[model samples]
Target: MVSLAAALASLAVGKASAEDWAGADAETGQIADIAGLVRLAARFPDSGSVALRLLNAQLAAGEMTAALQKIVVLYSRGYRLSAASEERLLDMADADQAAWLGSLFGRERQSIEASTVFATIPANALLVESLAQDPQSGALYATSVVSHDLFVSVGGGEWRALGLRDAAALTGIVRDPRNGMIWVSSGDPGLGSEPLPGFRGLIGYNPAKGAIVRRIAAPEGSNPSDLAIAPDGTLYVSDGLAGVIYRAAPGAESLEVAVPVGTFRSPQGLAVVRGGKRLYVCDYRYGLAWVDVPSGKVNRLSGPGLQYLDGIDGLWLHGDALIAVQNGNRPMRIVRLVLSSDGKSIESARVLEQANPAWTEPLGGTLVGDQLLYIGNGQWNRFGEGGAPDPDNPPGPTQIRALPLGK
Candidate 1:
């Protein structure tokens, strides 16, 4: 577990953009002043990082009552305090407060038991981002961030690289259910060794031929991150750097903006729902939102039980619910958010996995039958300047976990 101060500092230097406010406040730098953090906590009430920072500030200022109030609110939202945080609160509390704190800590849920490993990738496949599985043949394909290549594993056998031509730091990949063609999102995040001069868009690969058949370029200045395919063959891609969502029609040659800029701060994951009428997008800094495909109207998903939807990286629709991989949250978790009838609000949320012993950082996944197979140990932090792997501290073998979604 990361210390409170270190977490606060990490949130302070996050990406600066209109939609990048998931953890930090509005200002670009650290919010050391109590008044600023108070406003920040109010703005993002569900953010555990902001609440912890404000609590630390209050304790440092000798405002015990305010600190206790924040703790109560956090507790109500199912946020657990770290061991160090609990000790600090206990030291400042009176007898009644101390007793309440003890009870709160006692009720903390134990870590979910580790899931079964479905497959393991060798160390060469650096920073695997997203995954796709062929429903008919059980062939698994993974996208790499550092290597800018696609890897394939057949029948749970050894992983081998399938070279992509002129690709730049592959992010998202999905199999088009209509025609069985594999689609992957390609973008230059300034991390790859070989920079492709004038290409940042989607690549359509035919797995049977082992070749890329079609290529569609995104608009200028776009870093497409995640891909979602609707039932009707329309493709949706999220641009994390430009704060836009692009859509390409069934046979269109180029991509068009579905949700324009200034809408989301940094969109990461996308899920199409309601027979392709609605699209759910996960903004890394903001929470979850759904867009009306025809009218382009966006609505923020809200409910009494939908508290920590801000930090999700990968999202998939399973029946009426949404399974999210939330690597951005503290003590990163995999959550299941049950939706309402109309898909406008989240009815309830359940933590499927948290504090797992196998996680370096869970990134993206795809639904395979009754299980969600995802990248269990995405070593994104192992990369240094210019997205190069550190020779001295090389990443270990990557594990992909199979998390069962029980009926």
Candidate 2:
């Protein structure tokens, strides 16, 4: 909120141009005085863009309180918020119910050309006699960052439940190759309508404790669908809802942003293409798309069998192409896509397997080691199946199943 005096002063400036807001690099060097922006907006009155810029400025400065306040102001003024913006604002407020407001409301750096390799899982957990298991024997599994003990399940059998360090939504969990510490993302575990103010990122999990004892800040509003690790240890996580990709490395303070920058929309399943720095961003509905780490641009792969590859939730680099898990109850199928050397073209894609009619659901998945794929098979109607899920807590049950990708 700006003072009457400052508001009156901005009235003199009249209008602000594109030059008014700094680039991602120099923006922090610019002042994050929300009051000043508000003043300028007061003068222009038609400064919806200015208000949004101010909001982003405040966010970069860690002034979430001011940032969110401005969102409310913008909304009351009929400022149409994008999904990404609305989600972040709601995530900051820790509002779950606010998610229903999606229709209304609602980084980067470096030049690393990415490559990808694929993995396989023939079957997700086929619920036989009411039990589930992991695909990879040594795979690490945690329900979310906000649970009991961080559970690391080895072998394709029932998992012993463990809790998380804090109450952060579990985005993507991957075993860090360097130290084997499972890196996880935690933020306002995006669950309810009213969000919790002061909510931010937190991480944990150590070798000895088998849980995250220390936490850190992660990028906001990511229900990370898939986790990818570069040979260089560059960490990548995909936000299913925001269509944004978050990059991080070991011992980094904050995460970095990637291309198509949520400016595009709806990327659920993501993976690194083998032999290159190109990351494939599979849309919630579209087929496999590639993100050039250097240019920060995205190119969608489509044609013939590649067409209508909807509800892709998981991606992996396999051999000369990429394999994806189609997320749907009826339209369920595990498909494989071959990429061209140019990286811009898709040669062919095929459905490797389909879910059994009896057990009709699948979500995100991962291929374990050399032979198996672990599918996070979800339950009917509820989240986690057969659990004492508190209304305040999510009961989204998704069991890990072992599928043979090789055979």
Candidate 3:
């Protein structure tokens, strides 16, 4: 059996492919096929895709008992298997096993409460990935991933397109509190209406002037996906495609690599803590970790009783806890991770919202005083490759929700 420590150490090696099977274990000298899958499942416990692969592998190896055990594990995690897959499992199980497995269906659906729509963006905006709020005027700003535009709304009014439109696939929007300049990350994930030959970087817009004041180009071939502003006004950006973190000192013309490549696999959401001394980074595949801002040293955050932290898309620091938008999870939930006093581990995780009926896939959000205003329906599936609308999946107005976080 692979130990948890060993599995985490090899996390940076990346996720296993579905076709990966037939290998020898270098550590235990055992057949590594099933063991490798087991290690992946352990690392990504909340990933329904990984769990299904493990279950299929067990069944293929004629390990019926192991397959049944995997099913129980899936049930505990609230993973919903497809009807066809469930039928196959029942066909292969004994009467007693079938009876037990039948009761696990529909348990993954959770009730949604305490969340309401704050604003709605029209369908023409396409896929909006992130939002920001003007601290002074209470205006909301949203960035689009498909339409390649930035939009703004005031006083819960309709969203209006802003002037900036040169970037390809705008993402992650945040406002610098000191200057009130709204910053947004732009990248090309091959989801744009027009082909932007070579444009991927960060754009700083002066909300007052309605114009882009500063622009910083990301590294060549890097897709800058998210942004986080520290308490001191320093900007931190995550390159999701390149697995790198970039930092820019206030008013700096260029970006410096804070955490170099190979440290994370697909880093998404970023949150700063300890007065910007430590940055909590959420790696979509390997879960969450802390990066020392000055030295760039990384320490994975883990402890007993912590829920799986993988698949988090948006992370925000709320007092002593982190609110995460987990769009990649099976059911796609919002969770609050209360940090330990030392900020090294999670003491507990509370679900603020889950299985939200209004969400297609929750993306990025901003913390407003004691509440979180997030994009509820992302509408990513409505668009196909190269930013064409999928006829089968018609687009709908985007919904942003306001979830109150009391002190």
Candidate 4:
């Protein structure tokens, strides 16, 4: 994370625009401006440095509720506060707030209970984004953000690689139960750039034979973030940079917009209804969005009794509830959102896990029976100052854990 002073310096010199604050915050230094920084942090939840500065300002101002919220948000974003800073904040808090801060930021949750380590992805494929597993055989499939290979393991066995070297930054993967084939999405390395030559949108791999079956490319320059395969084999891809969801029917010539553009702000994970008639999308800027498949209409899910609902990266439909991996909020965690009768608004949210020691940067996952198998630590924060992977400081093995739902 960039220092607050340097981030403010960019704004002072006009080196960064209002649209590029996320990038500007990482460039360096420290400064003050509590209200403005807090508002900016709320707007761009992904900017860890902005949130950090807000925490500093809140501590100085003796704002208890606001400070706790920033602490939780920073913790959720995987940002650890400095010992001096934490002590200063604690000095200003009451006993109750102190205890809450200790529990919220401490590693005590690491001892609450341990989720089973389903598999350990190789160090070479350290940045795993999403997971998909076969129900019958319990074989797990994982995608890598830095490598073109897909990692697969069966029944807690050793992981094997399925090469898709032609693709870059593989984001999401899913299995078709009917054919037992795995479909994965890959596009440009990051959201800002164009796709390299010969990029594929959604590629199908025959796991049984360990060979590529087919490749479906999305519209030009589209960076597919996450995908959900319907019961009838229709594929839905969320373009994070474009803020549009594209749908492709089975054996279709190409991909097309399922919902109109501007329907979301950086839509990430997606979950499809069994009939392929509806979808639940995670909008990074906005909250959750419910998409009507047939009408191409989208509605944001919001009302009373719902808070900390934004910053969701992975979403899964589990019976009547929607399980979400919310990495973009104050306390990075997994939540079970109970939907209303109309399937539009959230009645309530139950946290499955939060402040777990294993969460370095949680992204996506797959469901295996009663368990939600997900990447516990994606290590997205390991990147260097230049916004590139630092080879000299490599991220170690990727950890996969199963959050049992007791279904």
Candidate 5:
């Protein structure tokens, strides 16, 4: 009799799950034929074996491109890439195949100027630790902090890395429609010696020019992790240290909506749904909850799955369902959890995308229109040697990629 753990381990490494099976067949929106199964197998490849079955097919068909695509595809659909697995892939890959896989690594001197993935587009941002979308233009604003960039591509323009002034790595990004400015809560400077801990919080850039517009710090010493701008332009900031949420109306600096946010312990993400009718906060420490913008009423929306995780890092409202991001241990992961039909609690969770130790750090995500933009930070990588950069650690692939929204 195989032990239960053994059985479960075997299952994970053997064949693709029904959920992954269904995702690979996006055309029919259902899993049916062997071709779809083959794709799923190649992409996800069960739990234990690294889906060697799929890799063999890739090698046989000479679909090296397709094979690489499949690995990334599997990840977009919530598959975490482990370090051991990367080592295995590298070891076995032939010359051409090895080159393909090796190409994904980042360089210290050379930066990924641009990257585009035609894989399935998920309505949820996979690893997006923080997301900012425009309610009016339907345009999206996402920051790939690990990559040190801010991007906008609604009307079509390759994902532009809106460079920041003082070596900025944005966490929370949003648009100022009124002023036509894109702002992000900036981190410390990267170029100088011992850069300040958290330089001016609000860092804005000009979309048209890709230049830094200005940098503004929270008036009363507020260090924010995520930010949401209201309909009237009143910005709501989730203060990571204080475990509190504050509002800054337009030009004013003093915090306005200083209501006591319950147990914001380790809480970071926030999204405004229905044009500021309410604000959703991922208390992370507690779970996902929201504050009624008008009445200031707070409620806990945590249920069985999604928000209950320890690294319940970020949250976003995708139409009816409230999407969540869980960056637990090791194989950092991403998920597009669905709310129960009642619009109250989490019912079912589907792994939209995942980040393992090698490719990138799984932080959190932002849910865009059928698009999930995830953020990664190697600064705190758990599996390998992770920590803040030394004098010149040669920025570890500070780049972000947009996964195709699954059909």
Candidate 6:
């Protein structure tokens, strides 16, 4: 008797061949070979042309159970079938299969409101992470995670690509409102390529000229993740791997360690508080911490029942509240945390958006006017082992959604 583990293992690595379906008709044989078909489907979930044929075979043999399960898993893995493939699936699906699919992907079927969705323009790159609104022109700019390009869009306009030179892994962006120069954090060399003497800090870009004006390098062997600009134009960057925060002036030639190592675990997002006297930093998994600018003393901020602060990627300060895009949480959500009078601790927090339909690896966002414009669907999971988006299962259009501020 085959054990369940062995059966699953066999299915995982098994290969299906033409001889396996020789006896049965093309239709019946495909569905009859359930285990083999599933194995093929699993290996090629992104291949719409492949998955659609398998689904048809399963339908031909009345194998709805296996087909249903495969469909759900493929969708979860970021598979969007072609129009013809989708029509076939819908036409062949039974009431039960249709109901299950509807319940699972109902949110995606509906159109997101234009007001809430700032833009639905397609970008040249995928896996977009950080967003910054041009306060002067009302244009929104975004940086790609896996691609080395920046995108800008006017109010409901098309997204124009601005290529970056020698910079990969662009993570965060913030426009210096004082001078309109954009500050972007990038690990241009990419992971494992570090230790090669290269720039590993911020890229100062002139939006008007659409060119990089300056490249500020961080300490040797550092990967900067998120960035925050102080009221006085001081830049605060979190080095997730180095476990330190680096500080630099806008036009400074070099970066100096601001918060020494071991201050926080995997620090990501940062927000400089009012008066520029202190800074709030999210340690990714260690909740939130504040550092006194005068002393550089880092202290954790706790609230009632403060247990975990895992998965906080984008942190923004609005008035006295801290808006956090907590994608690490199961189902993911956007939270509004009100700080105490002293700005020392979180008094309370409320869910602004929870179990949201638009969330797909929510990353960074910025406050624009009265709305919080964020990357709604990053589609980071669409990348295959080769680090490129799978052509067979192409992602849908990227969306920049706006959530009302103070909500």
Among these predictions, the greatest TM-score belongs to 3
For 1-407, candidate 3 gives per-residue lDDT tens digits of: 33323423433422222221111112322323788778865554444555666788889888987787766665554455667888988898787767666666534467667789988889888888889998778799999887778999988787898857577779888898888999998888756555555457889999888898999888777788899989898889998767789988887877889988667767899998848899988877657778877777777675333355777899999998989998877678888888878787777778888887777788888999999999888887888868788999878888889998765
Write down the TM-score of every candidate.
0.84, 0.57, 0.86, 0.74, 0.54, 0.68
Q: Tell me how far the alpha carbon of residue 388 in candidate 2 is from the true structure, in angstroms, after superposition.
A: 8.6
Model 2 Cα lDDT, one tens digit per residue, 72-147: 5555432345456556666765344344334334211112111121222221211111111233335546433334
Arranged by lDDT with the best first, the candidates are: 1, 3, 4, 6, 5, 2
Clash pairs, candidate 6, are none
Put down candidate 1 lDDT per residue, 1-407, tens digits, no spaces: 33333323443222112222233213412687899888865555445666777888888998877776666666655567778878877887887778767766677565785468989989889888889999888899999887788999999898999988888879999899888899999887766555545358999999888899999888877888899999999999998877889999998888999987777767889999848999998877757788878888877676453356777899999988999998877667888888878788777788898878778889898999778999998887788776778888787788889998764
**Candidate 3, position 353, lDDT:** 85
Q: Point to the candidate with the largest lDDT.
A: 1
- Model 4 lDDT per residue over 153-206, tens place: 888888888777587678888888889989888776462244454465888888
- How well is each residue in 1-407 modelled by candidate 6, as lDDT tens digits? 22323323443321111111111112322343556766654432223334555666777788776676555544543344445666666677676555555554544632223227767757456767888888778888888766667788877577887887877577888888788988888763243333323357789889898899988887767888788999889999988766778999756988889987655556789999868899988766445677888987766665433223446889999988988887765446677888888888777777677656666666787997667888888776776653467788776677778888654
Q: Which one wins by lDDT: 1 or 4?
A: 1
Clashing pairs for model 4 are 4-30, 5-29, 5-30, 5-31, 6-28, 6-29, 72-330, 73-330, 76-332
Q: Please, what is the whole-model Cα lDDT of each candidate in the order they appear?
A: 0.79, 0.49, 0.77, 0.71, 0.51, 0.68
lDDT of 4: 0.71
* Cα misplacement distance, residue 115 of candidate 1 (Å): 2.0
Question: What C-alpha lDDT, on a 0 to 100 scale, does residue 152 get in candidate 2?
Answer: 44
lDDT of 3 at 151: 92
Q: What lDDT score goes with residue 9 in model 2?
A: 40
Each candidate's number of clashing pairs is: 1, 50, 0, 9, 30, 0
